[model samples]
Target chain A: MNGPYVAVIGAGQATAEQERVAERVGELLAEAGAVLVSGGRGGVMLASCRGAHRRGGLTLGLLPGPDRAEGNPFLTVTVPTGMGELRNGLVARTADGVIAVGGGWGTLSEIGFAMRLGRPLIAVGSWTVEGPAREPSYPTADTAEAAVSWVLRQLG
Target chain B: MNGPYVAVIGAGQATAEQERVAERVGELLAEAGAVLVSGGRGGVMLASCRGAHRRGGLTLGLLPGPDRAEGNPFLTVTVPTGMGELRNGLVARTADGVIAVGGGWGTLSEIGFAMRLGRPLIAVGSWTVEGPAREPSYPTADTAEAAVSWVLRQLG
Candidate 1:
């Protein structure tokens, strides 16, 4: 089923735990019949794409470079942005919601853009962003199960 | 003097202290006879552009959208990329060096891209990037004076 398409933003180079969480998150989302979207590089992005693809779920990668060669091996469909990492904004902005795993600045930038766009942002072992006291900065979850469930709830 | 062009990446929604640092960085870079480049939006980018313009230094803003209206007030020239944040890569890649002030994720992503391309990255109260132990993740500067000096030294 072509349900809510969610984007997962993380670093191309990630720690083992981060990669593990990303794969689990992707698997859960695919099992739920959700379409997967990622930066289409490596680390969490690659893991998510692979998880979705293996489960027969549709996957899309919004690649930054002009060529698809830079994309990860798991992407089912790659859209060459030729924009570079600024494509982070496009990945987050176009998604219905976002799941941020352990990441570096690139992931943070995507989070910033998603937050600014008022998209549903769920951080799983990711950055702790604090905003004004009155405003909401988004939510954080402890595990992949919690993150994917939250995304589904948001789509529902 | 057209000595060099340095990019300053930081948060669009910045604190007074962050903005002050960014402005000072711009001023110092301009005083050194170097051109300033930024995202050309609000917060630190706008502050930097303003500082450069007030100092009679050339400033370029790589704006995201198709129009120049989104650019900061002090920009001498705004090149609309229409590539959205993807222009961040262009800004970082084209600059002689990058000075990162207090910023959010967008700034972080630029840092990531710049580092991957082996551009000298100077962090001023910004991200703590970690890479291979043998390679310098990036250098951190305590003040705008130090940051600008470092960029100049790199160019020299």
Candidate 2:
């Protein structure tokens, strides 16, 4: 399947659990030739960036404010959207699929955006999204391998 | 100062370093009686939430998609903007000053949006916006207290 950019929406600061998950997910995305897109900050986004960078993947950070320099160091390209949390939907739509790790309202919003845009979405521990039909959202393994496997199936 | 509701923008997954900063910032915001606005996810925003929540201050989350259920538990009010990342600027603009913590492109975009709107901005923890301003960009601080202090001065 053609590579797709997947947006991972979550907190800027990551817990140890999140770091483990991000590392695994990063490897999966890199191997599958998918780009990881995030808010370009710390927390889950940065953990994911570190994972992706280690795996030789391309990581894009969609910064909300105006400065490109504020992005996480791992980000290969930083898009200073000059937007705010409102742009969260754009970040979700830009991706073919979405992976939401443990997050708060921002991650929740991105998941909602993914559903609104009809993008395939996968949730790891503590993050979930549903379709209009009231179908329960699919829950994936916390590890990167399981998450990527599910994403590949959706793409297929 | 009018007790401005400053938007703290960043990713959800914060690192250890970020958590320490977040804790400090939370205390400062609480003491300053400033309302914290964010994407309403985790990370720096949540840390702000924890700080503000303790003092019973206001916390607003402008989510990306439609479901308020996806918002952070700490969010006292959740606005479903449904605009995605494109609305990032709107979030930044809703506040009088913007406080960015360890961020990425999304945070960068928030900074950019703040700059474009000519609003005062504060950066903490190496946010790229801290660099010497080519124009009338605001100042930067190593910690959240200093950033909030700087923002209050700007608002004044």
Candidate 3:
């Protein structure tokens, strides 16, 4: 059977804390035998892919630009969409569940799409968006372990 | 030379005012010899496509789902991406300029992508996002004519 596809959404420019969290999240997802998906650029995407790659896990990168070479070296597969920021939607859609690390506008867009598509979502030190009634849409975790565990549980 | 591609973005469920604005935007874009692009479903998308179609303008629908039949019949060409909300990125990328009539989370996502990609963008009765310094990234217009004029001017 195919492994669960879990996307880790974040910004290309991430803080040290976010990068550390993203890497740990990737390693955990890899150990759990889930395929990791990401934007395939730098920062959080690179960190996650590196962790997964070191663990010998399959990693997919949906790159925004036209050059596959631009993807993080750790990606097992790379798809360069040449669609620019639009590829954020693909990164969100191709996953069974989503874990967002520290992010920005792009990550926020992915979060919006993920919520709209009803994908199981978890956030860690990420942007918190409210519904029309001002209720938090998804749960936020404090650690990569919690984020991975929560997202996988939701997938199951 | 090919005509300019202008995307009109908004929610599938729109208010009457938004629909009116979107349709007028479509008419103006078509009259200006521009190609109209959208998510190609209902609400604002259908309204814009309907206006453009009535004006004999070429309308392109980047559908989120797999079925072209789901697209508004006003489209001259329909590309069913089967990418779900990810097609929103394509809608933003394919346009030379973007005009958001009225929106929600989805539109917010598109606005994020458009700004991230540095696409000429405008809003009309739509979401207003603030940047790091609380500055609006794009211009907002009070009417369809003003929005179209501002966006086309930006393109030039």
**Chain A TM-score relative to the true structure, per candidate:** 0.94, 0.90, 0.96
lDDT of 2 by residue, B84-110 (tens): 665565677788888777764456556
Q: Candidate 1: which pairs clash?
A: A86-B85, A86-B86, A108-B105, A109-B105, A109-B106
User: Per TM-score, what order, best first?
Assistant: 3, 1, 2
DockQ of 2: 0.05
Q: Report the lDDT tens digits of candidate 3 across residue range B4-113.
A: 99999998988898899899999998898899999999999999998888888899999989998999989999999997787787888788899988787787778777
* Per-residue lDDT of model 1, residues A1-156, tens digit only: 458989988878877888888998888888898878898999889988877777877888999899989888888789998876768778877799899987765676677677656678898777654332224566889899999999899888
lDDT score, candidate 1, position B115: 67
lDDT of 2 at B38: 84
TM-score of each: 0.80, 0.51, 0.80
List, for all models, the DockQ compared with the true complex. Answer: 0.21, 0.05, 0.29
> What TM-score would candidate 1 get against the native?
0.80
**Which consecutive 10 residues in model 1 chain A have the weakest lDDT in total?**
A128-137
Ranking by DockQ: 3, 1, 2
Candidate 2 on A1-156: residue-level lDDT in tens? 358888877667567887678767877887788989888888888888888898889999999889988898899989998766656757777888888777655565566457546778777774432221234454656566777888878877
Residues A8-51, candidate 3: write the lDDT tens digits: 99888888898999999999999999999999999999999998
